[model samples]
Target: MSKKKKPSVLIYTDGACSGNPGPGGWAALLSWNGKEKEISGGEPDTTNNRMEMRAIIEALKALTRPCRVEIRSDSALIINAFKQNWVGSWIKRGWKKSNKKPVENQDLWKEMLKAMKPHDVTWTKVKGHADDERNNHVDGLAVEASKQYQ
Candidate 1:
């Protein structure tokens, strides 16, 4: 018998920080079928990159089942990590970078990898604070969520 295809999901994510290591927030907009869901959270002390990774991890965790997911974000760090196989290299090197230094946000990277295992994920890079309405909306949500900790 032919296997059934997984549901296709589109997710938009963004992260904001009031002061780099200060209050930070992450937001994600997930769309599937005719329904859409928005999720967001904040941290009292976090970096923008951590928040960015958090957005992706949380979005994937929100999925009830395995899916074909397309994630759009303005974070080149997140996108390039997968596109360039940096995560694989890091893992092979005992979580160390090419410079022989420890990778930053290694914890979240592990979480993200776990969250992604159940799905076929595609990463798309978008221009932040640009003309994309969805990107802008998610950015606003992230910024607002960060303000909650202020």
Candidate 2:
């Protein structure tokens, strides 16, 4: 008898901001092998960037096995950080930004990296509200969550 390989996972995430420094929320949808899981949370006072990072972290944490992950997000901060190799710089330098300040959302970033260590992830940037169904749905969920929690 041999163990069957786990299915690959796809995740879409969106983070909402009521105000730049106001209420914020994050939403994520995880899908694998015909199963879907939606997760979300909000902070009474926060920024969209943090929520965006949190969404990715949460989605990665929810996986049951090491698998391929496709993560979609509309957040430039989160997308750029990965796409631009900024996280690598931060990690290479002990998680400090260019100015030696602790990277914003370091806790979540650390967790995300750890969660991702056992798997492979590919990040895709989706334009918000531009007919990207999964991203839009997650965005709506984040918005609703922010409104409810604020």
Candidate 3:
């Protein structure tokens, strides 16, 4: 007998802020087997990058078991960080960047890393505020969340 395989999940995430370091929000949309779920939250005072990482972290935490996941985002900082091994390098160098500066969001980055440890995850870059319907939806969710904190 063979075990059944779980369907892969598709997730879209986005983050928004009233100012670079002002009230912010994060949103994630998870879909599997034609079922979709959306989650979002806001921070009274947070940076856009923190919200972005928070969105991904929260989405991965929603998974019940180890499985393949494809996450789409409009933040190149995230997609490029993983694709270019920026996170690995930072961990290897005391959470400092190439210039020896402390990583801006070490705490959030660490949380995201731990949340992603059990799954095979892929990151795809999507154009922000553009034609992609899913992206647009998630972006709208994030914007709404941001408004909640205002």
* TM-score, per-candidate, Cα-based: 0.98, 0.88, 0.96
lDDT of each residue in 19-138, candidate 2, tens digit only: 988999989999888989999999999888888888888888888778889888888877788889899999999999999998988888887789889788888888989998888899
Error of 1 at 44 (Å): 0.4
- Residue 77 of candidate 2: its Cα lDDT? 77
Worst 10 residues of 1 by lDDT: 141-150
The parts of candidate 2 lying over 4 Å away from their true place are 1-6, 99-101
TM-score of 1: 0.98
Question: Residue 93 deviation, candidate 3, in Å?
Answer: 0.7
The reply for model 1, stretches above 4 Å from the true place, is: none
Better candidate number, 2 or 3, judged by lDDT: 3
lDDT, candidate 1, 11-130, per-residue tens: 999999999899999999999998999999999999999999999999999999999999999999999999899999999999999999999999999999999999999999999999
Give lDDT for model 2. 0.87
Cα deviation at 88, candidate 3, in Å, is: 0.7
Model 2: colliding residue pairs: none
In order, candidate lDDTs are: 0.97, 0.87, 0.94
* Candidate 3 to native Cα RMSD, angstroms: 1.1
